[model samples]
Target: MNRPLYALLIAAAMLSGCVTINIYFPAAAAEKAADRIIDEVWQLKKEQGAKPEGNQP
Candidate 1:
């Protein structure tokens, strides 16, 4: 019984080690997304600056 348990554990460990994870994303898409975010931030800043300030003492 002990031998079988040890064999099962070793087989599980080996199989788990064989797994591989792959992540893929397009560079052009990422660049376009970044540009859009930057443009939005810049536009917001410009709009904020353009607003007239309230009367101050």
Candidate 2:
């Protein structure tokens, strides 16, 4: 009975290291997506040629 319990504990400990999780995302793709979202949310208009109302010189 002790041998079986010891074997089971060893098996569990060996299998624990085999589990893995990895996640990856491309930086360029994320930046492009963020730019598109910001443009949509702020309603950037380039074709209108209207001066932006701001304190910007």
Candidate 3:
């Protein structure tokens, strides 16, 4: 009803109209990342429970 209220409503409406959203889905990248993680885990397992520079078991 007031001038300030009307101006505020107009500004809000203009701002709401300027919204943009972007979504990305990278399946190939995700598969590559998973492969790298698996490789690291296997390497760690192989190095566990073994002497750093000795062959004694």
Clashes of each: 0, 0, 0
Looking at candidate 3, what is the lDDT of residue 25?
Answer: 56
Q: How many steric overlaps does candidate 1 have? A: 0
List model 3 lDDT by residue over 1-57, tens digit each: 599999999998877766532235566567656655875986545344432433434
| Candidates 1 and 2, the one with greater lDDT | 2
Q: Cα lDDT of all candidates, in order?
A: 0.62, 0.63, 0.61
| Model 2 / residue 7 / CA error / Å | 31
By TM-score, the candidates rank as: 2, 3, 1
Tens-digit lDDT string for candidate 1 (1-57): 699999999999877766532244556557656766886987644344432344333
Q: Give me the candidate number with maximum lDDT.
A: 2
Name model 3 segments beyond 4 Å from true. 1-22, 44-57
Query: Is candidate 1 or 2 superior in TM-score?
Result: 2
Off by over 4 Å in 2: 1-22, 46-57
Error of 2 at 53 (Å): 28
- Backbone steric clashes in candidate 2, count: 0
Native-referenced Cα lDDT, model 1? 0.62
